[model samples]
Target: MRIQWIVSIVSNLVSMGLLVIVMGQYQVLNIQKQREEKLKTEVQRLANEYANDDLSKVTMEKLLADGNKTMTELEAAMAKLSPELEKKRKDVDACQAEKVRSFFQFPKIITLTRQCLFSIFYPIHTNMND
Candidate 1:
C-alpha cells in the first residue's frame, strides 16, 4: 500500500511540471503572434501612405520637365556670356599688369623728383650769391 501511494505522487508531480512547460511555450507563441500582427499593420499603413495618385504623378512629371527646361536655359545663358566673361577677364589681367609696372617704376619716379627739386633750388641759391 505504501508503494502505491509513492507512485501516485510521482505521477502527479511529473504531470504538473509538463503543464507548466506547456503554459510557458504557449505564452511565448502568443507574444510572437502579437508582434507579427503589429508589424503587418505597420506595413499596411506605410503602403497606403505611399500609394500612387494620378494627379501627383502628373505634377511630378511636370516638375521634372520644368527643371529640365530651366537647366537648358541656364546652360544657354552661360554659353552666351562666355565671350563677355573672357573679355572681362582680359581687361582685369591688363589692369593688373599696369599696376605691377607702376609699382616697379615707383623708385625711379622718386629719384627723378628729387633731382628736379635740387636743380631748381641750387640755381636759385647760386643766382642770389652772384
Candidate 2:
C-alpha cells in the first residue's frame, strides 16, 4: 500500500510538470497572437499611407470611411505593381546588356522603405519560431 501511494505521488508530480510546460507554451502563443494583430494593424496603416492612396481619397469623399485601409486594397496595389516593376527591370537589363544607355534604374528608396517596414514584423516571428 505504501509503494502504491508513493507511485501515485510521483505520477501526479510528472503530470503537473507537463501541465506547467503546456501552460507556458499557451502563454507564449497568446503573446505571439497579440503581436501579430499589432503588426497587421501597422501594415494596413502603411498600405493606406503609401499604396492605393486613391482609395483613401475616395473613402474620405464618401464620409463613410473607417479611416483605415483593408488588406484587399494593399493586395490589389501589389498585384498591379509587381508585374509592372518586373517588366521595367527586364527592359532595363536588356538595354544595359546591349550596351545601350538605359535611363531606367530600380528605385532603391522604395526597396529600402519596404525592407524597413516588413523588418519590424519578420524578426519577431523568426525568433519566436526558433
Candidate 3:
C-alpha cells in the first residue's frame, strides 16, 4: 500500500511537470503563429499594393491628404499593433536565440538531465579514488 501510494504521488508529480512544459511550448508556438500571421499580412498587403498601384489609392488618399498625417496614422497603427507584434517577435527571437526555446525546450533539458542521472548509475562502478 505504501509503495503504491508513493508511486502514485511520484507519477502525479511527473505528470504535472510535463503538463507545465507542454503548456509553455503551446504558448510559444501560439506566439510564433501570431507572428507568422502578422508578417504574412504585412507582406501580402505590401505585395498587393505594390502590384496594383491604384489598389491602395484609398489608403494613399489618406497619405496624400497630409504627409505628416499619414506618418502619424501609421505610427498610431504601429504603436497599437507594434506591441502585439513585438511580443510575438520577442517570443520567436527568444526561441531562436536559445536552442532550447525553439520547441521541446524544457522537455529536452529534462530528458537530458534524467538520462545523465540514470547513466551515472552504470553497471559497474568507476574508481572512486580517481
Q: What is the C-alpha lDDT of each candidate?
A: 0.95, 0.83, 0.86
TM-score for candidate 1, residues paired by index: 0.55
Name the best candidate (by TM-score): 1
lDDT-based ranking, best first?
Answer: 1, 3, 2
Compared with the true structure, what per-residue lDDT tens digits does model 3 show for residues 1-130?
Answer: 9999999999999999999999999999999999999999999998887878866776788778799887899999988998899899999888787865546578877899988887786533554535
Pick by lDDT: which candidate is best?
1
- Alpha-carbon RMSD of each model: 7.5, 37.6, 47.0
Candidate 2 residue-wise lDDT, 3-75, digit = tens: 9999999999999999999999999999999999999999999887876678776867666444335566778
Better of 1 and 2 by lDDT: 1
| Model 3 TM-score, all chains together | 0.36
Model 3: lDDT of residue 67: 92
What's each prediction's TM-score?
A: 0.55, 0.38, 0.36
lDDT of 3 at 78: 89
Once fitted onto the true fold, the runs of candidate 3 whose alpha carbons sit more than 4 angstroms away are 52-130
